[model samples]
Target: MSYSSHADEDDDVEIEEEYLGDYASVRSIVKEALPFQILATIGGAVAGFIFAGMTNELEMIPGLIVIAPAVLGMRGNISCTLGSRLGSAIHMGLITKIENNPELTNNIYGSLLLGLIMSIALGIIGHTMTVLLGFESAGILALTSIAVLAGVSSGIILSVIAVLLALGMFRFGFDPDNVVTPSIATIGDIVSMLMLFLSAKVVLML
Candidate 1:
């Protein structure tokens, strides 16, 4: 019995060591991801500049300035969550191929629903805040329209990008967790800003 116990302990130690060595350490993750993170940050900064350039037009819509940042941030949040989920699925071997699987469908639907709900909430909150601050603002209908349109459009695009990045990274033997979130965030910034601008234009015209 004592000998059996000792053998079990050795097996456990070997398994633990193997597991520890299989996973990435924090330093290694940071080193591998730093260059991509820097590039993504630069892309986000360019998006910010583009957003700044559109301030004149954005100013024309009352309370839109308040909604812009919230919408952009929410896009990143939603897309990052999606990316994380895909990365986990990839690591777990749940996603063998990028097809119309139930898991992928559910994730896409959930992200879209979350984006829509959050967009509407942000619209209402932005309108209320602008009113409280003694600023002129559009009605809830217009605000909601703009938010939903922009968020849904951007969500669709970002969802596809997130999935593709996860799959591509995994296929290339790179951990998706190390690259997907930052990449999605940067792309979300650019795409969300552009979508918001276009949505606002369309909403105002209608």
Candidate 2:
């Protein structure tokens, strides 16, 4: 009888956790995503302000803003995917620790490589579209160089943050999958914008 009582208590606790974590209904779905949305909105506003302050940089490197959205989106997508993968790994018991794991290392490497290729492609596309639309372009080489530099740098930073944040949240008994997407979107926006502006400055000097 004692064993049966304990089992019932455990089942109740599990049910409560499921209710809190899962989107079984509208209230639960909002509960899961609301905080992240609030944070993401604030981050996006900050990013817009940062972009506004880059007027000088914009003039120095024409058409850079055209690729800003692409850069931010790419970073967010990669980081979100990494977070989701790590969360799954944690739940599946594949990763008990964050450090010294081959899986984590390989994931980081793959994200970086993908970012590099996208950076080059975005640069070319941005330049081509700018010229085709009769807008001033800083040239294919300059735009491509900036994208590669900024994309690689932001990708490295964001990949680490994604892994660490997801692991930390999972350890704390929070739903990393629920939180990672919005959290990464916010962080990725800020980091990608900062890296892009800095890269533009560096490319200007070259």
Candidate 3:
């Protein structure tokens, strides 16, 4: 009814509007980020398929069918998991060097160590499976074991790389969400396959 009262009401409304605007922006960011992450994951899987064709000529059918999936899955899974975990840590404002967060550093190290153990185990399993199937590959078991171990080691290395990249990107004013997951997953796929080959070579030489 009075001019001052009307002015006061207008000021209150503007404050509410600003708050709502901030809330909406936050929600939009969440909505956009989640879908982007999902889409990136699917795209990474597709890329793996396309790259498998390049290696298909190497071992032919069985190589593409068995070896490709094993290497690809192991790398992708490990890298993606580690990347996601690191990203979450950054999001929670818990990112510090080992000197700062020894627990975090040790946890990541332990995970990588476990990966190595799994790699050895998987190698044994791969070799045993091949033998059980009556495949005439004498030193295949040893080769398989080494290959998996090598892959695990490679995965561990890549996990470290991913963490470094994510931290650096965050420090350089980039979103870890956009920087870490996709890049790491793609790199992991390629590196895992490469390590698989290297492991096979090492075992063959032994």
Candidate 4:
């Protein structure tokens, strides 16, 4: 009876330690997150540059501006979620190495498909809003086509990059969660914006 009571007490103490971490644990967490924060800042700057660079494309494509923010935000949101899932998979040891992995492929495919569908929907919504707001906008067909093309191309490229980054971090014996945020924000933003404008250029041919 006394032994069982001591075991229970020990379990309670461990739970407390887990929740109320000591100073070293807190310091370690901050140290780990600091680098990611810096990288995220750099990503924000790059995203800003992309935003500025798209001014001409936006002007050239009548309805491009309407869907621009949605496209940019959608990429980050989806890719970030994908990266987080991958990070969890890595921690769970469900994924080993970066190649010849069926699990990785499925996750990538799902994220891509989701992004593609959202892109088409966003294009339609943007086109509708633009027309209703009394703004001169491109035809629905043109806008929707641009969104589908851009979203697919960017999704494929970013999925590859995301998997590589997630696996790379784990292979190097580091936590992917530590930096996936910045990776998704930075690289995803750049690629998505570039594809958006490039698709617009092709569709508008202006």
Candidate 5:
């Protein structure tokens, strides 16, 4: 009985050590990721402020307010997905270095194509909703043009940023999964808002 008890005690100690080691590893990753997360969150807030400042312009178009959030949210969603996929590829050793590769090219094209299709759909939906709610709205063609142009412009920029950030974090020995999505989301918000505002201005002018 005494010998059995001693062996059980040794096993418990080993298990405890293993648990502690795993905890420490997770803590280290969180520590490494926290700063980048904080910065990205701050960037997101700034983007919100910019969006708020565009209220007057949005009011002029009546239904544009409906379109704005969809555009911004879509950009963030697409970019976030892109970041996650690239991070996974990095972890899997599929992206050994940051250069032109089939995986990267496919992801870029796919994301951009999706963005283009969704932008047109969102524009139509936004315009329909505005009319149904008895609000004046720009023509569907104009709205669709605005959404597609802004979306494509922002999408292109965000794709590059996501790829670079993921690769850069991996190169620095940090986990790309921990940093890429949040960072791209923040950047996506800012760029999408800016591009939307500019696109609206340009489209309305024409």
Candidate 6:
């Protein structure tokens, strides 16, 4: 009986080792994907079109008007990029979350905190630059506040979606390299534009 038990333990160890080896192979496969990088470029072009249309419709001063769309686009792009990176990292066991792994959780929190700070700074700079350039349609403080809020919210939301989608793909044995980045970026752009438009409309009403 003891001999049989020992054999069972050995089998379990071998199985675990095989699983680990397979995981490494999967990670390497994902890393080799270069074509996936084009998603960022594609996402950017799409964002440009959306922003142009939204801003043009507003009829605000071109200089002041451009700030909202430009910053929103940039924020959305950065958020999507971060989401892709983090999603990949999380899947490869490079990071873990509190609910999943304590270290990963801390890293996610830190990323979000930084996102908030960056959003505020970017918004303020965009509004200030326009104002300094003598474009007054987008009231500096109000527009800045809106930009900051939108950036932070968009960043956090996209990150969460990316992580969830990546995990789901992994569970289903799907290739995240082919699935995640563009989808998250495209979705993020849509949401970012909507947020910017809503905020601008609200500010104008105030």
lDDT of each: 0.88, 0.87, 0.65, 0.83, 0.88, 0.65
Instruction: For each candidate, give its TM-score against the true structure.
Output: 0.89, 0.86, 0.65, 0.85, 0.86, 0.64
Candidate 2 per-residue lDDT, tens place, 72-138, comes to 8887888778878887887788777767988878888988998999999999999999999999999
lDDT of 2: 0.87
lDDT of 4 by residue, 141-206 (tens): 888888888888988988888888888877766668877767777788778888987898798673
Pairwise TM-score winner, candidates 2 and 3 = 2
- How many residue pairs clash in model 3? 0
lDDT tens digits, residue span 106-140, model 5: 98899999999999999899889989999898868
Instruction: Give, for candidate 3, the lowest lDDT window spanning 10 residues.
Output: 56-65
Give the per-residue lDDT of model 6 (tens digit) for 1-206: 69999999999999998876665466755653444556656766776676676654367533436565565557655766666666677568775442566555654576577767776676677767776877664555776666766666776677677777766765677556556766676678766776676666666666
Candidate 1 lDDT, 54-142, residue by residue in tens: 77667778988889999999999999999999999888888878776888878889999999999999989989998999999986777
Shift of residue 1 alpha carbon in model 4, Å: 5.4
Tens digit of lDDT per residue, candidate 3, span 4-59? 99999999999898866653467745653566567657766765665555553344
Top of the candidates by TM-score: 1
Q: What is the C-alpha RMSD of each candidate to the true structure, in Å?
A: 2.2, 3.9, 6.4, 3.0, 4.5, 6.5
Cα displacement (Å) at residue 174, model 3: 3.1
Which ranges in model 2 have alpha carbons more than 4 Å from their true place? 1-29
lDDT of 1: 0.88
The lDDT-based order of candidates, best leading, equals: 1, 5, 2, 4, 6, 3
The parts of candidate 5 lying over 4 Å away from their true place are: 1-24
Task: In model 1, state the lDDT of residue 106.
Answer: 88
Residue 34 accuracy (lDDT) in model 3: 66
> Deviation in angstroms for 29 in model 4?
2.3
In candidate 6, stretches whose alpha carbon ends up further than 4 angstroms from where it belongs are 1-57, 60-64, 94-100
